[model samples]
Target: MTRRWTDAALTAVAPTTWGTTYLVTAELLPADRPLWSGAIRALPAGLLLLALTRRRPHGVWWGRAALLGALNIGAFFPLLFVAAYRLPGGTAAVLGAAQPLLVAVLTVALLRDRPGRPALLAALAAPAGVALVVLRPGAGLDPLGVAAGLAGTAAMAAGLVLTRRWGRPPGVGTLAATSWQLVAGGLLIVPVAAAVEGAPPAPDGPALLGYAWLGLAGTALAYALWFRGAARLPVTRVSVLGALSPLTAATLGWLVLGQALSPTQLTGFAVAVAAMVFGQLPDRAARGRRADQPARGQRVGRPAPGRQVEQQAHGRHVGQPARRRLVGQPARGRLVGQPVRRRLVGQPARSRRQASAGASAATPSGSAPGGSSAAAASGSVNRCAADGAAA
Candidate 1:
């Protein structure tokens, strides 16, 4: 019901859905069809969303959408699939784990967001945890696949930062924004998918089901939630959730495939989960930080407008520089027989204090401060001080 809880729920959905992707790809989808797989996954989901929402991107948004698609979806998907296909799932997950660090750097460049201590710690901890959860000591990598995986992670990170930077257009809902990127990404995938993988032969039931699931759940729903979180939350917080994908994939393998989880694997998973929780903690201290701090040109402790006006009035009437006033010094108001001479806005108190001391010392203790002999003769002790003040 609350916004924070709603955003947390939405944030969880993005990476949790992504976790199922690797398992879905290896188990259910057609093999050796990365480009085609990407196209099929993105295009149909995008088209369906567009049709349902009845919204098309306008003006430069068309190009912007295409660019985001290319980064987040088109270029990212095929590369991701290639890595997943070539590397063992664990190795692929480790490579994907690098995304949070990449996002931290990109946030600085794109969003101008300097990662705080927690963000930096989370960035380091997340990948280490993922490595523990997924990367086995014996796990090996392919050169090209390793390159593809790292590249895809970087692209995804950049896209995440950019999504936060260039948020959705006015009046466009999350579904519409997701559709635009998906469509653009899908279109980019099409020609490549055609040239490289071509059309798929008629699929049996399982493959068809896999494709349907990948499109509807993975691309459509996952991206909808991902982009929504990116638009609403800090990019680092959104990307930190990426750690869940590997954790999910590893857990599923243990659960569904009946793989025995060694103690080390369990430890790793626990560490990753801990890191994920820490990463999601709200960095509330950083908010409103810039406001209390003044700009470079701003004067520190500057007087208010009315105070300045009062200073100006004093300057005009008294025939003295405003600097004669000292803001912190005791008031000069009606010192028993001396007219006021204290400054209220500028200059050091040392000079004024010395002058006051000289004036005080020169007068006799029996007389008032103004040293009026007539007030001394009056002999009314209270009125003597008052009469000398008037004199």
Candidate 2:
């Protein structure tokens, strides 16, 4: 497939799979041992992909891959499950809504790109939507649960940014980068999950199915697609599309788990989505700008006059004078008719004096006998010519 379609498919697949997490968590999975489930979901599956691919990372890629793994998967996935287990499903999803806005803000710092005018407003505005969705009087949602959700969202957002900034090392594909994170996260969580939750009573058929799907499809396939997109597109744009994750989860909650969406919740979803769209638009505009930029070595092979003429042609506005002033010309071209006037005004007084002297030399000298005036005019013309030449 073309990279664009591949990238879109990958990005869409992750959120689609993730949307099922809430329903799976509530209906099929064990309640108290969330981290263990997360660990199992990540580590073994990641290693299996690595083994199947027959790939190994090299040199600094090992350390960089480890860091990438920690940021994107290891830190994010388990913390995400912990938050979901602790918080109400809808409230947790609302915290996930903050991902796009957080990514847009972080991209400005991490990638050094302006989030643009609309993005600036959306960055401030989207959090209000998240607040409306999560903060309620009788929901029984604790501050700690909300905080954990926010922390996980932030970690994921930062991970996405870093993934884009420092992509996988040469000779390694998306699977390798993803595997490192999966293994690292899974390994980190194993002892913790074991120490805290111990071994659970054997899961029933549906629960076992849930764990299998979460491990293989959710952790492995979803990340594979996510890394594909991260490798190809801006992190902010990727995060904007990821807003679908919460919506998907909400819809799945309604269909599978019987969670009803209130009008306020719907409004929050709509507003947050609009802000994400707003954040993404600037990146599309920037992509166009980069496309318009002169390609490498395009100017080098052209002749000097041709290059200058091309630059002038590129720089000039339509309906302007053909003989535009050169770069050093005073009164730079800005307003209409100004450059022509500036050119005329800037013609040195010495030029006119030289013209007058030349005129005298061209005509007969009426005032001097034996053409003394001719000699005098010749001297003046010479002097003027000399001065013009010197000046």
Candidate 3:
């Protein structure tokens, strides 16, 4: 338990910082220049990472890195900006909250990965939790914003699955891989930002600070932690942690803006946090494996060293439970319905009484355990003994 939490600590950094993205966008960044903000956030950070690492994508990795970056950053950044700007923060948040579900579904469809019930339920439950935290009676959702939000969610989900599937190449570190994606994503962002918004005024002090923080902490550091987590942990587990982002956004809104959190908001906050924590738990299959393994001090089977020797000594494997043996009975391992009509060694094997009794005990029709050799072996011995006594 401690170990899982400790390992997830870096992954936790990404979403926790991301929670502030909404806050920074709303409070600090200039209006009508979200694309500019995204570009500034990603490009420089990516370049800095590239400069620091001095590594480049090799061979087919160039294409793979581009695709990943486009999904996670290029398309995702612009769409996310639209969602943040056009929709009520909570409405956008609810849309963002659906990311885990998309990731879980895509993993199942593409990777053939099955998420445990807890992770699935937590993912399904997150939107409701976010709605609770941020939704108000007057919170109106915009169609364009909703579409953008969904698209961004999908883009990020696809990127996450790919990150887990095609991990960092040999000799390339996690930071280097992160830099590759960022550089590609940032480059993609460049033309789009210019074409759509043309060029925005030079960023003022607050906007500049926001851009610096986003580039340094949010984009570079956050993605480094994200790919690191995805590389090591199950994709579903890492995705579930994203619930923290909306929760963080809501808490920041309440505190930073001095807006009071209502009773319902508080309840929603607790639920969201609880769901994220619960979703990180090991799946049922993992838990079952751990449970089935015997304690180190106890012996459930033969020693690992002696298992092969034991198998060699006996024609049968030692691990398999031995079948019960009937005394003085033929060791043929099949169920006998009745005495054979043919003679054995030119003499009848059993008397008429034995055939009649054998037929009475078991019918010709038989299955595995229900009508198997077990019943025939014991029944035959008892009937033969009874006949001998009667004689």
Candidate 4:
């Protein structure tokens, strides 16, 4: 349990650090260079990781690496920056809060993993809480920014699901795999950045420091932890942890930027935090139900041995007691559709002898009819019973 929580905490650090991106971009990074921002953030960290790990993708992993990188990093970063720039921080964060829901949907569609009820509700509640915290009554809605935020959220969701689906290759560590994706995504962004922006901006001391912080702590360390958690945990659980991003951003705003939090905002903060905590809990109901269920091929409510036989023989209802067999009847092997023939118990041998003699006298000996033969057979059976009794 401790280990699992530790893993979750580490995974959570990724989004928590990512929450600083909006502040860093606003304060230290250059204006009107979203593409350059994305390229610079991704490439250096990826290269550094590649240098440290000294591993490369082999076989189909190359394509998988590129695809994952494109969705997670290449496409996600620039679009995220665009949204951040175009909309209010609260509005951007609110849009990003939809990530959990997106990831949940993709998980069901791609990985075929269904989330529990608590998780689904948390996914919904987290965004609503974020909205209360960040969204103002008259917040401007830029169509381009809204589209960008939604698109970025979707790209990240797909990337997260795919990460869980494919996992890392045999013998590849999280750092190595993370490095591969970073490099692939960074490479994808470079040409696009160059084509769109024409020239990259030169960084001053603060900008460089900001870039270093982003590349090392935000991108490299964050993504490594995120992928590590995704590989280890359920995708739904991992995705919901992203609620920390906006929460962390709000916290930083309050602490660093001296922003005031209203009572409503505090309530929202409480709600979002509750949702995140709730989302982490194990699905105890599902587990309990599974535990209570019987294993495969196991019978339930089986009848007792004698009762089972009686049911088969007489077509009796289940749970009914077995009926006692009649006197002089065979213990087993009663043929189907045969009539039951029984005799009275405790009858005297003298009576049986008298009955046999009478039966023989009634039958005609010279020309035997069906009735005479039947009477003779009955007398023979009675005589055998009398002889046994006398002996």
Residue 167 of model 1: what lDDT? 92
Query: Candidate 2: TM-score?
Result: 0.69
Candidate 1 lDDT tens digits, 247-339: 889889888888778888888877887777777676657656766776567567764334443333223322233333233332234444343
Model 1 clash pairs? 325-343, 325-344, 326-343
Per-residue C-alpha lDDT of model 4 across residues 115-193, encoded as one tens digit per residue: 8877888899888888888877789999999999999999999999999999999999999999998999899988999
Model 4: lDDT equals: 0.82
When 2 and 4 are scored with TM-score, the better candidate is 4
Write down the lDDT of every candidate, Cα atoms only.
0.78, 0.68, 0.79, 0.82
What is residue 229's positional error in candidate 3, in angstroms? Answer: 0.7
Instruction: Report the number of backbone clashes for model 4.
Output: 0
Better of 1 and 3 by TM-score: 3
Candidate 4: residue 10 Cα off by (Å):
1.0
Which regions in candidate 2 have their CA more than 4 angstroms from the true location? Answer: 1-6, 118-137, 276-278, 282-391
TM-score of each: 0.74, 0.69, 0.75, 0.75
* Model 3 global lDDT (CA atoms, 0 to 1): 0.79
For each of the candidates, the C-alpha root-mean-square deviation to the true structure, in angstroms, is 10.1, 11.9, 13.8, 13.3
Residue 289 of model 4: what lDDT? Answer: 79
